[model samples]
Target: MGVGRILLNILVVLAAIAGGFYQLKLKPILVKFGQGRVIDPRGNTDCTTVPELKACEKLVLHQPSGVVYLACSTQESRPHWLPNAQRFNATGASRTDYVASYNPQSGKVTKLKTVNFNSPRGLSLHGMDVVASSSNPSELWVYLVNHREPLSGDPKVVGADSSVEVFKTTLGGSTMEYVRTVEDPLLLTPNDLTGTPDGKAFWVTNDYGVKTGLIRDLDLLGRATTSVVYCHETEGCKYAIQNMHGNNGIAQAPNGTFYVVNAIGGQLTVLEKQADNTLIITDVIESDRSMDNASIDSEGDVWVAGFPKALVLVYEHFANPTKVVSPSTAFRFSINTGPNSFYGQKFKVDRVCDRSSYTLSVACHRIT
Candidate 1:
């Protein structure tokens, strides 16, 4: 072995070590970090008028007072590196996700307390009581499929199973307090929920089963194997309707009729309560856009949040988190009950809000 041969051997050894480190360690870490990264698109558009409206996931209105409460998840804010890493930050902390209250008369929004749970997606309120579904992954064991601990802290402190949070608002609509959290095995992907008039029992929509990756995507594109569960204080949660296609929002009318939106099917199903407390499908109304949550106004009309463009807004949000703008519309429909049949009348569809944001729930001010 001469000097040149020895040098060549040394070079080969060093190159082999570098290749192993890159292939085995560095690549996996990069892929894991990339999963949590968000790429926001850059652009600007001024459509604040009628054609374009602000995006909101859930909206609840105080009937007599006309105070509108909105749950704006700001899902785009979730994927950024620093915020994703820290569940709680001491310095320059990120804005907490909150339920915002909009005064229809004054046009002023008062943001309530930041929700304790992550990913506050859907919201429903009756009188001063409110219920919402939190779909945070660490909050739910289901999200562990692609779980990556926020880069900086002990993963244990930041992650837990998901649940539904209940709250009560003051009559003045100035404040709210956390009442209790509902964790049930039946609540596998709880999306939107509606409370009873008395605020005792509630109904929730599970968007999908315990699934992820391509299977979940395919299930959504096809008919979703989701269901709606009725949750009670003593009896716990039970299945109300099964095998729904993208079950989303749910609302109950004053007459005890239930209205549910099948997001993928683009239709609203009207359910009537039987003597045994089970619900019977009374009617189904076709919709032009993907329907989300439904709220019954004082006049027995149902107000729904409509996603006109399907999942284009969702793709845009993932591609360009910041610059993505999606259109949102609200529709008002009337339900006429006959002795033998049920009829639905489309009163009007209003382009209330727009932008890159999505609206989840809708409610009208009713003095109940």
Candidate 2:
């Protein structure tokens, strides 16, 4: 064979190999882009007319009066990857990190004037009171895994500590009052929390380990080493559930079953709290979408917020918040309370909210 022909053959082989690699590796990511296409909840093609719900997380439903409370953080803040970051380019902008209430009967949302904090993530209501995890930069540290130098001399390096802020409210009232703040080292990266029946204790989920930045992402994507800590009034905090893959939301059912959502693992871990205060995984419900925070209704129904296209939605939301609205779904399921085994089936999924605003939670308040 001629040398020219051999060279042409080798080039063609290399091109074919590159094409195969692109199809095998990069095609899936490309395909995921279309998966995040916003679906009109009103069954229409135009999404501009669709109602926009406030970006919220850690919803807690007060069953007595049918009031659903959620943590809404609508302000543009610094990037988690950047150390000692500040809110830039926002001249007259203000942070809307407060607790909001949804009235099912009137179909109205009322922003409560109670506890105001920066970057409130997880929330839970105990009777007439509520507790939320405030993950401000001062309370929560976002270490740059790639950058070794500390963020020294940065004036915006404030609130790098972590704490759980508590608030008091009425069962069906629209007003609230700031109570106390629980600061602890065990609450590192607290994602979600739920109060006990007596309101004397609570459990918060630490989604990641001490390692931040890229290493924490890899840990969440692989073997999750985080845990759920039980914070008691007199005993401080202790581990209740361990080895969770991005444990985001937690809710205790009326029957004492604990429903924990793993964001990275895309699974709902059903746990049972023993008499000794430890938790045992009873069942696990797998999901195609990445699950966030979850809430349990009085009737034992589970409501969860999930990202249909996790990669695309997350990327688009962080990249261009105005152009690409993150699409999310509210999933509802019922647990089959059997004698020995526990299982659940997803009964419904409502795509009524745009997660581009960063909707991180869902809850249902059933009126008796």
Candidate 3:
């Protein structure tokens, strides 16, 4: 072959190698990041955007009263100090983040006053749960993932000194009393939590094992270092399930089955609680978008809120939530008792609602 012909052959070889790399490596990463995927928007007609509620990262409902408790902060603040997203501008973080309740029946939103809880940093809210008191139906137990800045160190360096804060409130009362803060090393980077009715114990999902590092970012690209930590008031916090990839919000069903969201990978992990309070993974439900939080309703259907465009959510919406619109999609997962159940499709997934907003958590009021 001539010199020009040999050069042409070399160029062809390089092109083939690049094509293989794109298919085997880069494509999966892009898909995981929700890039270039055609979004078929569904269930957009029924969602009603409450202009009063903005920038709530988590929501839990008091089923008996049809009240939804929200872990909320101003949209202006989340861009600066959302630790899970690694935007650790502590000075810009909201000091007055609050828990509010929305009554579907009355269509009234109330910001539950924090009584006797005086942390200097106030509440930098994230994932939360509001469980009815087992002993008294009139009382409610609130479990919050508080992402307070580190006491003695820089938040950018150490990440948020996150903890599960337990509180109590009445059925229809406006005041919520602070009980105690459960802080431990095992609460590495708590993203979301599911609490017991008594409020003495809870299971929190640590979205990242290594705090404030490159490894934490690599977790998006399949690093299985995230975990679920089980914390008790007296026993402290311990890892119930470890080496999980992209663990985010956790919701427990009425039957005691737990559904954990994989924030990056777009999957739901079904976990069963053991006798020792540890969780065993029983099944996985796959999805196409990145999910943030999961909530189960009175009927035992699991509802998940996800980002249709992950890049827009992280880069644009979180930065300027008011102006830029990031589409949020809610998925409903229920046991497939239909004909598909015989084909081994155990769960039926439906896109119940989709709207343009920074939706981090979701709760279903009815099956429709």
TM-scores for every candidate against the unseen true structure: 0.63, 0.67, 0.92
CA shift at 289, candidate 3, in angstroms?
1.3
Where is model 3 poorest over a 10-residue stretch in terms of lDDT? 359-368
RMSD of every prediction: 13.8, 8.6, 2.6
Candidate 3: Cα lDDT at 128: 92
Q: Which candidate is the best by lDDT?
A: 3
Let me know the TM-score candidate 2 reaches against the reference structure: 0.67
Q: Is candidate 2 or candidate 3 better by lDDT?
A: 3
Candidates sorted by lDDT, descending order?
A: 3, 2, 1
The residue-by-residue lDDT of candidate 2 on 79-145, one tens digit each, is 2322212222222222334566777667777877653533333332211224322432111110000
Q: Per-residue alpha-carbon lDDT of model 1 for 229-275, expressed as tens digits?
A: 87776778888878767677787776789888876665788888766
Model 3, 1-368: lDDT tens digits are: 89999999999999999999889876776676678865666666666557788888888877777778888899899889999889899989998988888887677988899999988978999989888888998899999999999988877888889888889999778889999998899988898998898879999999988789776777866889999999888888788999999999899887779999998888999999999999999999998788888888777888888777888888987898878888778888989999989999999999877665445445445622
lDDT of 1 at 305: 66
The superposed Cα distance between candidate 2 and the true structure at residue 198, in angstroms, equals 3.4
Which whole-number lDDT from 0 to 100 does residue 68 have in model 1?
63
**250 in model 3: Cα distance from truth in Å?**
0.2
Cα deviation of 157 in candidate 1 (Å)? 18
